[model samples]
Target: MSSSDRLLLILHIGFAIFTLGPLTAATMATPRFIRNQNLVVVRYLNRTTRIYGIGTLGIFLFGLFLASGDFAKPWLSASMTLFIVALVLLLIVERDQRKAAHLLETAAAKAAPAASSTKTGGEGAEEGEKAEKAKAAKPAAPGADIAQVERGRIAAMSGVVALLWLVVLVLMVWNG
Candidate 1:
């Protein structure tokens, strides 16, 4: 391959690793954090998702540049299609994650009053203990079930996206 081709290939691979690596990590971690009801971790993962989502554009652009002369190749076409599919699926997963996070945040806000009231000296010690136990036993939120279901969906979609990425990688390495 020529120098320019080598450079483009390097850039394409670099962007792919830089963009997809964190994306996969964040995507996988999101559901786990959601299950734990750890909003802090969930929010951090969401931010990583957003940042990597934008970085994915570079992967596509560099890939196109590398494949500019090989557009007619069947493997290239298939890889491109898979890449698009994965991107769309990832976007859906990201949206659901954000929605789940919001639902959790709202639920926490709703429960905060009970927690604060329990902390105040106005409440008897026994009452405060009961309140704390009740709060712990209470469901995540009014929509906590819905959020859990959504997280499950996101996890499934993200798995498919990860599979598509692997397929695209295989195609590029073996057939491109």
Candidate 2:
């Protein structure tokens, strides 16, 4: 391999590790935080997913450079196709994260007013506590169930994206 190709290979590998790894982790962890109604962490992970998702483009670009426009190689073409599919999946996952976060925020906003209304100096303290317990035991509010579905979808899609990355990596190592 030429010096430039070697450099490109190193950069491709570096981006794959730095970007894809975090992207996978962020997507996987997002559903759990969304399920827990941790909006802050979910937003953070969403941002992380976006950043790393963009960073993954570097891996593709560098690999393309390393390939030197030799698109005839079956493994190279297959890896490229899989990588594109993974990017599409990640984009969908990102959108789902945003939707889940919005749902959580909406639920929290609706609950906040109800919670404040329940407060009546010290008079309704016991009643408020009981209400809170009952509320906890009650079925999820309208948007909450949708958020739960989003979380499940995010988890499943993220898993599929991660599997695509693994398949691409295997193609690189096994067929290259």
**Candidate 2 clashes between residue pairs 3 or more apart in a chain or in different chains:** none
Q: Candidate 2 on 94-115: residue-level lDDT in tens?
A: 9999998888888888887886
After superposition, candidate 2 runs with Cα above 4 Å error: 125-146
Steric overlap count per candidate: 0, 0
Taking all chains together, the TM-score of candidate 1 against the true structure is 0.87
How do all models score by TM-score? 0.87, 0.89
After the best TM-score superposition of candidate 1, give how far the Cα of residue 100 lies from its true spot, in angstroms: 0.7
Worst 10 residues of 2 by lDDT: 137-146
Residue 123 of model 1 has an lDDT of 48
lDDT against the true structure, per candidate, is 0.85, 0.87
> How good is model 2 by TM-score?
0.89
